[model samples]
Target: MILIDADACPVKTEITEVAIRRNIQAIFVAGSYLRVADHPLIRFFAAGDAFDAADDAIAEVARPGTVTITADILLAQRVIEKGGAALDPRGREFTPASIGDVVATRDLMHELRPGLEGQTGGQGGGPKPYAKADRANFKNALDRVLTRIARG
Candidate 1:
């Protein structure tokens, strides 16, 4: 199963296409209603407008056989703790060996965010614009991870 943190995700179209083609069960969780594909394997979940509500919803169902797509390191850590796999939208897979460092770095960045906010002078701030290459990378990574899980 593929659990997606749908809000602010850039590769939703690609994810939907790949899930349908692979006949995978993909549950898209968001803060509110989202128009999802009309298919048996494609599902949509509205987690409400509370903080981390969507992440909480996704984590609740995360398990050994599930793969969650999220960019939030904290949510990814929670999913990993539950023995599920987590992948960033940019195609980076969070693993047991790497999650620790990833979390620490994320925390450090958060701590430094206040100081760095105005220092950039409107340059080098926030995530880069999603590109075609990023979409392709995400599709490839999703396929590879799903194939690995299927094999197991």
Candidate 2:
């Protein structure tokens, strides 16, 4: 199963395309109803209006061997803890060996954001814009992960 944190996800179409081609199941968890392609392999779960509700829903369903897609570092950590592989939209896979440093860096950035904002007069840079290259990388990463799982 490929579990996706759908809110703000840029690669939904890419994921669904891959899932369809690979004959894999994909569940997209979101805070509200989102239009998804009508396909038997694709499922959508509405997690309701609550902070981290979608994340909680995903955590509950993801198990070992499942692939989770998310940009949230904390949610990725949780999935990794459950033995699931976590990949960001940019195709960066989070693993046990790297999650700690990623989490710490994220925390440090969060802590510094306020101070930086104050110093910079509320100007803050957001994540880089998604690009076609990112989509290609995500497709390749998903295919590689699925192939490895199938081999085992």
Candidate 3:
């Protein structure tokens, strides 16, 4: 299973394709701004109005061994605490014990680099570079996780 923060996600289509190919169930949690697809394996849940409503929804639904896609350092930490795996669209994975350090470092970066506003998704930057290498890397990671699930 997978939970995706669809509102500001960049690899929505790519993730959907990969999930479909793998026959995995993925629920995309979004706010009112995102228009998500309706599929058997992939569903969308609208959290109405709230800043971290989508995050709450995904965190509530995600379980151990499930993959969560989100760029929010805070939210990823929450998922990690719940024993789920969190991944950024850039393919960075966050674990339960490491989330605290990651969040602390991210906050420190914000303090040190005040003017540096990071951009992962959304229209604030140009189109994301979806290289073939990225696709291959994601595929490999996806397969590795699936293999682990199978092993267990």
Decoy 1 TM-score against native = 0.92
**Structure candidate 2, residue pairs in collision:** none
Write down the RMSD of candidate 1 (Cα, Å): 2.8
Candidate 2 displacement at residue 5 in angstroms: 0.3
| Residue-level lDDT tens digits of model 3 in 37-110 | 57788778888678789988888877787888888888888888887778877777777667888988876665
* Candidate 2 structure quality by residue, lDDT tens digits, 49-146: 99999999999977788999999999999998988889999999898999999999987777666555355223459888888998999999988888
lDDT of 2: 0.91
Those runs of model 1 whose alpha carbons end farther than 4 Å from true positions after fitting are: 115-124
Q: Candidate 3: count the clashes.
A: 0
By TM-score rank, best first, the candidates go 2, 1, 3
What's the C-alpha lDDT at position 117 in model 3? Answer: 54
The number of residue pairs in model 1 that clash at the backbone is: 0
lDDT tens digits, residues 45-74, model 1?
999999999999999999997999999999
Candidate 1 vs candidate 3: the lDDT winner is 1
Question: After aligning candidate 3 to the native by TM-score, how far in Å is the CA of 99 from where it should be?
Answer: 2.0
Could you say which candidate leads in TM-score? 2
Clash pairs for candidate 3: none
Clashes of each: 0, 0, 0
